[model samples]
Target: MIIPILYTFYLSFFDWNLIAPTKEFVGLKNYIEVFTDPVNQKVILNTLIYIIFLVILNFVIPYFISLIVKFFISKMQGTYKVLFFIPSLFSLVVGAMIFTWILNPVSGPLAYILKAIGLTMPNWSNSGILAITVICLITNWKVFGYNFILLLTGLGSIPKNIIDAARIDGIPKWRLVWNVILPMNRGIAIYVLILTIVQGLQYVFTPINVITTGGPYYGSSNVIYQTYLNAFVLYKTGTSSALAITTFLIFLILLFLEIKFVESRDKDYV
Candidate 1:
């Protein structure tokens, strides 16, 4: 696996078609072209915006949801956890397909409900930012339950003694969470951040391919979609490899920053 990835980096620098008689070295042309190409620029910007949205949805929203679920979980048996977590068990493809139907312009449940209320809903995959935002919304909804479960497990690790100490110290509920629970769970936060960011990059692809297919004028396509389109649709293997390599580099940098942040925070925790 590592060798293949390393080879991708080497191949990305060249203009080598898979069927060509001679592989030609193009230096940094592919990388340079990535930045200069209008479509590639749009994909990169769209991907960055998607990442920002997902980080908030995956890490921040899930943490609060877990806090809410924790309150209920303490009073009940494990039944509530099971019920809330059922969605996480379904395949991403299945979940995206289901949501696509719900968001369909004509026959979707949401559209039907809006019509009944004397409202007209625009097509979800409409031109411009609306398409990308809809894709982000669907991605967030599908991954939210699983993230909540992760945070719930982290919450469960908090000691009863600590909660009692905070209570005895006259700490307010919000203050207790802010000053105690959040700091104590910082490691979990960093872990979730890294995992979510990495997975978030790849997870948007299913929805983009299925719901939009880069439709409504390529509004929702990300780097991964571009790579797929290049390789399979356009048969531009060299350019596809370039896009793939760029995706890998972007994620690698993100992973590195996350590791550095996590290690620094761990020292502070120590």
Candidate 2:
């Protein structure tokens, strides 16, 4: 892992096609190009959009659902767990293909159902927002189950005595969850949150590659997709390396802020 990263950083300063015999020294030009290009900028924006949507689907929604299952639902809890987790067992490529067929605007089962109900299926591939949403959905379908189970475990691990005490004290359920359970589960929450942001990007790559290929004028492309395009398809090795390095730096910064945020929250709880 470290070797590839170190090599990528070294390669970022040299101009080379993937097949080139020798790389030409380019200094910082590749990095400058990655930052200055309009397409790359749009890809960055798309990446941020992906993260926001992914966090909502893979983190926020699962967090709430886990709470509901852990505290509210009494019947069929095991059944619900199995149902929620079934999707996680599918590979991303298979999941992407499955959704592609299910969501095909023309002849997909969804389109047929919508048409039977006197509605037309919107061609999601035609719109940037929809395209990104479709990709996120594929990723979410595969990721949400695992996240839900993890959060459920975290919630379940909260000491029953504390919960019983809260109830005996006539504390509202919401207050108990907000003021006590959430803080107590911070470590698990932090891990899940970080995993969502990082793995979300990686997970979407398959769907984007299989379905959209960053279509609608590269509207659905992300940092990882752009790097793959540059290195493999476009054969701009240096630019791809530079983009990878810059993306690593961006993620490093985000991770740092995340830790600081988690630490601050911990201090507040103390």
Candidate 3:
């Protein structure tokens, strides 16, 4: 890991190509180009968008859903868990392909249902925002259950004595959840948040690749996909290395902040 990362960092300072034998030392030129390139700027923006939506849909929504499923539907919780988690068993390519069929505006079942209801289906694959939204939805559908199960495990780890004590103190149900359960699960919550922040962009890459290929004028192109395009598609090894290093630095800072601010607070709660 260290060797490859160091090598990539070294390569980022030079003009290199995978196919070409010759290499040129550019000394920050690749990094400069990455920052100034218009498409890369858009790719960064799309990455931020992907991270925001992925965290919200995959982590936050699943956390709340798990809470509800664990508390309200305690009897059928096993069935619900199985149903929600089934999608996570599929590979990313398969999941993306499934959603691509579902979102097909012309011949998909979604279009058929809309037509039956006398409504027009929008072209999901060609529209930028809609395409990203579809990617988020599909990605969430595939992974939300996994997160849900993690949160459920977190909930289970909370001691029954703590909950019983809270109830005996006459805490209302909602207040009990807000004050006791949520606090007790802070460790797992922070874990989920940090994991999402770190891996969110990578998770969205597959659907974008399979469904839209960052289409609608590169609207959904994220940092990871852009790096892939740069290295493999465009054969700009140095530029790709620079982009990867930049992304790694950004996420490293984020992870530090999470550990410093969020995890520190979790310690207090725990």
Candidate 4:
């Protein structure tokens, strides 16, 4: 990892196509191009959108569902967990192909069901927002189970004595969860948040590649997809390296902010 990262950084300062015999040092040129390129701006925007969708669908929804299963439906929790986790066991390529067929506007069961209800399905593969939405939903569906399992473990780790004390103190169930459980699960919550942010683009990559290939336009493209296009498709190694470095820096900053924020909040809670 260190070697490749150093190599990529070294490449970012040069003009080198994959076929070139020798690299030409073009210091800052690749970085400048990456910043000035309009397509890169679109890629960044799409990545941000992907992160937002991932937080909502993958993190928030699954966390709440896990809480419900842990507390409200304890008797069937094991069964529900197994069912939810089944999707995550499928390989990403297989999952993407499965969803592609399921959401096919022509012959997919989803389209057929909608048509039976006198409604039309949108062009999920060709349209911009729709394409991104479909990919995000598939990603969420595949990963939600894993996240739920993590959160369930977090919830389980809380001491039953504390919960009993809260109950004896006449705290409502929701209040106990909000006031005691959530704060106690801060470590796992932060872990999940970081995972979502760092792997957000990667989670959707396979689906986008299989289902849209960055789409009717560049609608579904994220920074990772753009990097792949630059290095492999276009053979622009320097630009791809620059893009990768830029993305890494962005995530580094985000990770720093998240850690600082969570630490401060944890201190306050203490």
TM-score of each: 0.90, 0.92, 0.91, 0.91
**What range of 10 consecutive residues in model 1 has the weakest lDDT sum?**
71-80
Put down candidate 2 lDDT per residue, 1-270, tens digits, no spaces. 999999999999999997979999999999999879999889989999999999999999999998888887846777878999999999999998899899998999999999999999999998999999999999999999899888888888889999999999999999998999998898779878988998899889999999899988999999999999999999999999999999899779868867787767767767
lDDT of candidate 1 over 54-110, digit per residue (tens)? 888888888887876665346652675677677777777887888878878799999
lDDT of 2: 0.91
- What local lDDT does model 3 show for residue 122? 97
Task: Give the per-residue lDDT digits (tens) of candidate 3, residues 141-245.
Answer: 888888888899999888999888888999898999998899878878877877776766788888888878888789988889889988888889999999999
Q: Give the winner by lDDT: 2 or 3.
A: 2
Over 81-111, each residue of candidate 4 has an lDDT whose tens digit, in order, gives 8999999888888888888888888899999
Winner of 2 and 3 under TM-score = 2
22: Cα error in model 3, Å: 2.5
lDDT of each: 0.79, 0.91, 0.86, 0.87
Give model 3's TM-score versus the native structure: 0.91
* Candidate 2 or 1, higher TM-score: 2
Clashes of 3: 0
TM-score computed on alpha carbons, candidate 2: 0.92
What lDDT does candidate 4 reach at residue 255? 83
The C-alpha stretches of model 4 lying farther than 4 A from their native spots are: 254-270
Per TM-score, the best of the predicted structures is: 2
